[model samples]
Target: MDSFDEAVDSVREAIDRGDNVAVVSDPYGGRDAVADEAEEYTLGVERISFSSVAEADGYEMSFGGQVCVVEGCRYLYTRRVDGFAPVKSFLQTVVESDATFVTTWNSYAWSYAAQATEVDDIFDDVRVPSLSSAEIAELLSSDYDISEFLTDYEEVTADESPSLRERLPFERLRFGIEEASDNVFEKISGMSRGNPGVARAVFESRSWQTDDEPLDLSYDDAFALYVVVSKERVSRDVLRRVVSPDSLETSLRKLSDSGVVGFDGDEVVLRPQQFADAVSYLERRRLVW
Candidate 1:
């Protein structure tokens, strides 16, 4: 079975044993998908989603339900020294409650929380594994006509023209050139490090012929990007709390201009399509683990 299916099965088994489950994955790595599939397999699961610590602070667990699925549990805390109060309170409630809970967490946030609060001891973890190359190909093919793109295994001279197949009229819209190579998906999977979301982003970048230049970031900017990636999506206020305020504005502006991050009103988010590139840049600088 695929990793997602395996995770769902794990969740089912955990629930059957009356155990709370923690579904952990990288940002956009299908934690929600696994949780949703697990929830659908059972009936009468109470679903709750938290976008911020403030929202989590006001939530009260319902003793009436036997199963509950909590999405976005990563939002319950920030990286600041004093930011874990909401998550601590929430975890205390979960420990005290009798209901079995399925909580989804960003892997980075889970790592920090595990170290700080020993949350790994409370919930049975079901980690979502990264997609394989074949899986990545299947996923992209479902949503796109990837046959039109140039393949990595194919070779062509600089003066080579389109083949006869490229001259035919097509009903579906096409991007980039025709003639797909067999190794294109492999290249994408490697570049994305098996992350489905990042693979898709890389595929789109390749298919659309958009080139991403290497990023040159100051230490301040790199640190900021690291925090943003770890948090998944953080508010401007929370970001300021974790990063140095002196260079916060400059770092944010540089990141925003480079298309590594985007703003949603008061919140800053690493753009889904740019995730792989941003992570690669950060990793090279040892800013992200």
Candidate 2:
């Protein structure tokens, strides 16, 4: 079976054995898809979605001996040292209650929480797998009538010119292509690291290539980017507490100018279209594992 079906079966088996389940994935990974699919197998289970940490405060899970699916469990806390109180309390309630809880979390947040708290002991994790090249192609084909994927030649150097057939990246043109291969999808999948959302964004345009020069971030800026990505969407106040206060503002300004991140009122978030590029940049610098 495919990854989605395997994830659903894992959840079903865990529930059958009376174990709490934790659905984990990277930011913009397919956590929601797996959780939603699994929820369908859970007849009569109540699903509660927490949009923010404040929404989870004092929320008791009293479902009268039924299963409960908690979506957006990643939003239950920030990455700050002091910000875990809300999620800790929420997890405590889950452990003490009679309801079988199936929760979803961002993989990075889950990794940190598992290290710092008893989260690893409380839930059995079912991690969402990265999409294969074929899977990425299928996902893109569903939305766009992609008859052919031409190879991009903009980056080719004069000294090392490639034949039209050997160029791999998808060209912007949609029609009148003479050849087709899996190379284009493989390139996209590799660049996106097989994250579907990132793959889709990369397919639309080469987002990593900005008019501005390539990113040259300092350690503080890189760390700040890591924190923002890990939390998905973090409030500026909470972000300040976690990153170096002296350079936080400057770091954010640089990232914003590079179009790597954006602001939503008081919250800072990684730009969805730039997600793959940002993550790749971080991984290269050893800022993210």
Candidate 3:
């Protein structure tokens, strides 16, 4: 059987015995590896890939503020969900719900979690196991066994993936508070410094709070941010400052479709954390500018 199938069988046995499990693994054998296994081994699946913090929070609320227990949900795989804030919030929500959440990513993702005490506690109920490239090589070797591999290796030694770290050029585009247009961007930045969820809400709400305008984020605005922050795909000058919403909805819909933002019909919500995650993945792959 494939590794994913084996994982599903293992998870099924756990569920049959009325057990809750949280599986964490390395870059190679990630949550999806286990998720594929679960789908083959069991029935019923309710899965959502959050791309922004707003969407992540919405997911949390959908399950209720109190813990949301995902019963018989064959699998839950969170890929590259970054930023200290959104990750922490999502983890806490799942932990409080007492649900089984299987997540996977490179080393840096976990390191950031370990540093966030409150965020780290969210996974207190989940078991996180990592497999580095060296370990993967050992697993592929004829002399290696999963048990022996775990015992022989210490923590992973490979470098954490940068895409899983900061979401954008913010790492390279650090601006002084004085450089901020007004104090609001700075404040919003401060609130979401380590948390994408807060930053997303702040960015989207800027229009509503600053001016008496409605919370209408146009496609032009999104394209602007996409090109400006991403600094990859489209040129910065290509973004013209036009206060039009004609194309905004279509663009937001595309983002939401790709799991970058949250869309409930016309309203567009940016899960700063999840958006950061999606952006991280895209940026890592050089899909965006």
Judging by lDDT, tell me the better candidate of 1 and 3.
Answer: 1
Tens digits of per-residue lDDT, candidate 1, 192-248, equal 655787777777767324556778999989889987887777788877887899899
| Tens digits of lDDT, candidate 3, 53-154 | 234433543432111223211111122223334555555555555434433332233433455434344432232232222323233333323344333232
Residue clash pairs of candidate 1: 151-181
lDDT of 2 by residue, 26-114 (tens): 88888888778767776878888876555665566567547788887866776566777877888878878877788999887788778
**Model 1 ranges with Cα > 4 A deviation:** 149-182, 207-211, 284-287
Q: Look at candidate 2 and tell me the lDDT of residue 161.
A: 43
Worst 10 residues of 3 by lDDT: 71-80
Candidates arranged by lDDT, highest first: 1, 2, 3
The best-first sequence of candidates by TM-score reads 1, 2, 3
Write the number of the candidate with greater TM-score, choosing between 1 and 3: 1
Stretches of candidate 3 exceeding 4 Å from the true structure: 1-10, 13-20, 52-83, 96-99, 118-289
**Over all chains combined, what TM-score does candidate 1 have?**
0.82
Number of backbone-clashing residue pairs for each candidate, in the order shown: 1, 0, 24
Please identify model 2 stretches exceeding 4 Å from their true place.
57-62, 150-182, 206-214, 284-286
